[model samples]
Target: MNNLLIGLVRALRHHHWLRLLGGAFMLSSVGNGLTQVVVFGQLLRWHASPSALTLAYVLATLPGFFGSFFGEKGCRRVPPLRLLILTELLGMFALILPLLGMFYHNIPAMLAVQSVAAFLAGMSYPALTLTFKQGLSAEELPAATCMETLIFSAQVLLGTGLGVLLFEVFSPLTLLSIDAVSFVAAILLLAATARHIHLRPLQEMDTPPQVAVIRWAGLSILQKRSLLLLPALAAVGSPAMALLPAIAQQIRPGDATGLALPLLFARSLGQLCGPLLLNGERLRHYAKSNRHLLMCLGIFLAAYGALPLLAAEKTTALGLIFVAHLASNVVFALGTFSVLAYFPAQSVSGASAKAWRWQTLTAALATTLAAGLAAQWGATQSLYAVSLTSLAAVALILVRYRQ
Candidate 1:
């Protein structure tokens, strides 16, 4: 553990650009979390129903599809430092506009406001994605990926609690203003540190556009398996925490909200431990074995689905499932490391972007489908459906691995 911590510090100090980008990423992630709390709290203040919250989420995320496409376009043209600075500026503008709207008491159209951020983000998504993938040299991939996961675990475990506190202590208006300032800080940091980010000249860049497309269309057999097959299978295997409320309700009945936090906190602890375990020289080997890693995820998710029957009570079920959920995160982290370590750079056009996005969409669909199924087939039956989905993903992995 001490060695890992020391390695992370060494990497950060050794690469000034990594330090800048990592700082920006952490700040941006926290700022975004705090902003989300304020937005959700404001909706509650307006007495918006559950459906309204769902609509807001859908609105915010829908733009990502387009953003990833358009964002990469400009990123491909500009120098790395310029591209980094511009993306920060675009995000700053997007965030600040809604904040300004709130200050003037002219509440922007949620859809349009949300879509704008998504659109701007989509344009810069590739560059941002590359920040970790290619930002650090190949020698740093293991440490960088490990450190990034730790940061993510910290954000998830503590950020939610902090966001809640901030929401209570200050008004949404205040929160929005703080978020806008964070964006400005990120933009300024990139502008100042622009010189350190190195974009290696690629001979691949000079290839004719059509030839590039044809080449991407013709990826290696391994690349296709990692980018396409793995995600498609993981989609159904990815469990949705959105269903936690329903599960919590069954246990605590009316205190579902109260129980939700502890369960999620438990899950974050799992996320933290995942990176800790998948370390050492073995990290590279683990990151290469997508099939087995995903199979592990499927198994854990299947166990999670069976929690209702295994425990004979809500609290017991919750405890067992929390452990299962943690296992799922571990599996997810491993599979993800595999993708980043192996995904072909030429495949980034959009094929590889589907990785995280597809998992998210699949989880959302699973939640909605689970709810409807539960209403008709009963909770047990609904859980069985989830189990079946996960098992099916496992089957896919097994078949692919053998081939």
Candidate 2:
């Protein structure tokens, strides 16, 4: 434990600014976590039409669909540190706008602002991803990714907890205020660390034809075969996330907060353990590493497939759901690490961002479709649909692993 802590400290010391920037980036997520859960729960309580909630998801997730195009440019023109700082500032304003709406009794207006803020925040992820990518040595990539994952996990757990606690004591707006302060703190930390970092700009290369960063050209991103799996995976897995609120709903009225909080905590726990389980050394030494990844995917699929059954049979299965969700996220994170390892250094940031963009696009598209279906068929049915899709994906992964 002492040695592990020491290593983490050394890792952070290598690039103090990255540590600061990462912390800032993560802190902002706390606000986002609080804001999203509260809004989603309230929308459900209001009996908001599925279309309304779906529209919100679409608006927020839509920005990420084109993030790859912007990410490429952002990677080329902007330093990662500067990019991270700028996005956090944008996120700060976005968080504040909604707080104002909540105070003024403008729920729709708040949703609108929240949607746009989510879009910008989603777009910002790639730039931040690149920044973290650049901070690690080649040998440290897996551990670095694990550390990154752990940071995000920590954010989700703490953010969800804090958000729930504040919501109980105060209101969603109060949570939003606290979230906004976190963004400010993140920006300050990044600014303080800016002087210590020197990031390399992208090397000059032949430019691809200019494409709209925000414009969705029909089938433009879809043409990339490798990128296709990204969206497929996201689409198949995301509906289970919809189960989060339902699980919370089952616990108590307005108790969705408590249930969802633990899921996030469980996910973070898995993230923390996953790195320890699959360090760079293990990843490098494992024979048939692709098969290993496949095994993890299988674990995720099996766990996810059992969730509905568990929820139906066991009234107090939150603990089971937590373990299952944690397993799923760990597998997902491992898949992400594999994808990152496949990228060339020069392409890492651009590729990482674009991949995530594709994932979000597919997931959003899936959610929009599922939201409509859930309105009619029920959320439980929609979950089964997602599980079937994930099982098929797992099969494909296994087959491909064999090849």
Candidate 3:
């Protein structure tokens, strides 16, 4: 643990660009955490139906498909740093739509606002990945990725804990306003970082327009198989995660709002612990066997799903949730590390964008289906079904892996 902490400090000290990007990521992720809590809290307060919640999540995420396509194309033309800054600026303005939605108690308006925000965030992803790939050395990539995940995890812990504490005192509009300010802060930080660094434009990197598509097509069968699993994982994971607030309400009907903070804190705490536990050599070893990571994720999620069925106590449930998220972050971090290591630096952005596009679409569809299931079978039952589905997906993938 001490060694890991020392390494983290050294990595940040050595990479100026990484430090800046980490700062920007921290601000953005904390805002995201706050937005998630506020939006879900507002919906629950409105007594939103399962279908309404489903639609909101789908609408917010579906546009990312188009955004990823455009983002990949845009980055090939514009310098990634410039594109990143522009997206952040646009994101700052987009927060207003949600503020308006909150003011009017209009669900549709909030949905639209979330869609716009998701689109801009999707568009920024490729640019952000490219920026990192361009700035860091091959040897530095894993440490940087791990550090990024750690920062995100830590910020989530801070943000959601803070959000829950503040929700009682602040209105939705005020919470969202705080998110907008975060975007502005991130934008300023990126701009300052840009002045100090020299990023070669895509054209200068000699990447042809068709290279991304061709590169993906040319990946090894194992690589392709591993990447394809992402969507299935999303289908399994996203819905349960999206319905967390609802699940909290189910777990504590008398004090759903009160219980939510503890649950969120548990999940966030797990996220923070995951990377810390898998740092350095362990992360690399796991990245080499993506199938095993998927298997572990499926198993842990299944256990988490069964907790409610066992009539578990609140403390037990929280402990399981923490364990579940810890496993999730480990899998996610390893998967991301594998992708980054497999692709050449120049192709990383396009490849990641393409992957994200499909993953987002799958998550939207799965969330919608899960919502319908939850409406019929209850949230806990629906979560169990999805967890089983994920395990089944893993089984199928493992069968193929043996071939």
* Candidate 2 whole-model C-alpha lDDT, 0 to 1: 0.59
Ranking by TM-score: 3, 2, 1
lDDT score for residue 4 of model 1: 37
User: TM-scores across all candidates?
Assistant: 0.74, 0.80, 0.89
Residue 11 in candidate 2, Cα distance off native in Å: 1.4
What is the C-alpha lDDT profile of model 1 across 1-403, one tens digit per residue?
4333455677888888777766775666566556655554454445443334344544554466566555455545665466656766776666665566455644344335556755554455455555555555555566665666665565445544556666567876676667677778877777756667765444332334222131335655554454543344435443334344345545555454455445545556666665565554565555456555665666566665665556455466656655665665555555445555554343343443454445445544554566566567654566567757756765665456432
Candidate 3 lDDT tens digits, 138-210? 6666675676566557545877887988988988777887888888888888887887666654455544532
For each of the candidates, give the backbone clash count.
Answer: 6, 0, 0
- Provide the lowest-lDDT 10-residue window in model 2: 214-223
Kindly list the per-residue Cα lDDT of model 2 for residues 310-340, writing each as its tens digit.
6443333545555554555555555455445
**Model 2 TM:** 0.80
Whole-model lDDT, candidate 1? 0.55
Clashing pairs in 1: 67-122, 68-122, 70-123, 71-122, 71-123, 71-124
Q: What is the lDDT of residue 258 in candidate 1?
A: 50
lDDT of 3: 0.71
Greater lDDT among 1 and 2 belongs to: 2
Question: C-alpha displacement of 203 in model 2, angstroms?
Answer: 5.0
Candidate 3 positional error at 318, Å? 2.2
